[model samples]
Target: MNTVLRLATAACLAVSGYLHAQLYVGGYRVIPLIGPSFLVQASAAFAVAVLVALGGPFLLRLAAAALAAGALAGFVLSRTTGLFGFSEQGFQPAPEALLSVLAEAAVLVLVAVTLYRVRRGTRTVRA
Candidate 1:
C-alpha cells in the first residue's frame, strides 16, 4: 500500500483504540488491573502509526490487521458482558462501544485494501 493510505489507516486505528480505552474509566465494570492491558493494546495501534510513519509499509499492514481483529474480539466480549449488565431499563451499550466496533470494522477494511494494493503492485512490477 502507499505510504499515505497506510499512515491514515494506522492513525484511525490509534484513535479508535484510545476511544475504546476510555470505556474503562467511565463507570464501567473494568477492573483496575485491566487498565494496563487496554492501554497496551491501544498503544499498539498508535505505535503502528509511528512505525508506518517511519516507512514500515510492509509490516504495518500486517500489524494493523492483527490489531483490528483483536479490537473486534474485545468489543464483542464487551458487548456480551453488557448483556449481563442490562436490566429492565433497556440495554444501554457503553459509551463509544458502537463507534469502537465501527472503527474496528473500518480498520479491517483498510487492512484488506492495503493488502490487495500491495499484491497488485507487486504483480504489476513483476509483469
Candidate 2:
C-alpha cells in the first residue's frame, strides 16, 4: 500500500508538471504573469515527484506540501478573482484546466497522506 501510494503520488506530480510546462506554448500570451510562475511550478512539481519516488525525507515532503498549496492557491485565484490582472475566460469548465486541477488536487492529497504517515512513524520510533 505504501509503495502504491508513493507511485501514485509521483505519477500525479509528473502529470501536474507536464500540464504546467505546457503553459509556455500559448498560455503565456493569455496570462503573461504565468510565464515565469508556470516554469517555477513545473520545476517544483518535477523535483517533488523525484523526491516522492525516492521515499521522501521530511524536508522534501515539506517542500512538496508547499508547492501543492501554492499551485492550488494560484489555480483558484486565477480562475476566480484573477491573478496579476489575468482572469480565465469564464466560470465554465475547461477540459485542460479541469484536468490540471484534478492532478494538483490528487498530489495534494497524496502528499498529505505521506506526510501524516511519516510523522506517525517518527512518533512511534521516538516513543
Which candidate's TM-score is highest? 2
Relative to the true structure, candidate 1 reaches a TM of 0.75
lDDT of 2: 0.76
Candidate 1 RMSD to the real structure: 3.8
Please provide TM-scores, in order, for all candidate models, with all chains considered together: 0.75, 0.81
Ten-residue stretch with the least lDDT total in model 2: 87-96
In terms of TM-score, how similar is model 2 to the real structure?
0.81
List, residue by residue over 1-127, the lDDT tens digit for candidate 1. 3766777777778777777567545544255444555677777877886786677857776787788788677556555663334321222354466676677787788878878887898999999
Instruction: Give a tens-digit lDDT track for model 2, residues 11-127.
Output: 887787777787655456356677788888988889888988898765665676677778878888987888988667542235657777788788778878877887899999999
Output the lDDT of residue 42, model 2.
Answer: 88
RMSD of each: 3.8, 2.4
How far off is residue 30 in model 1, in Å? 4.8
Q: What's model 2's lDDT at 104?
A: 77
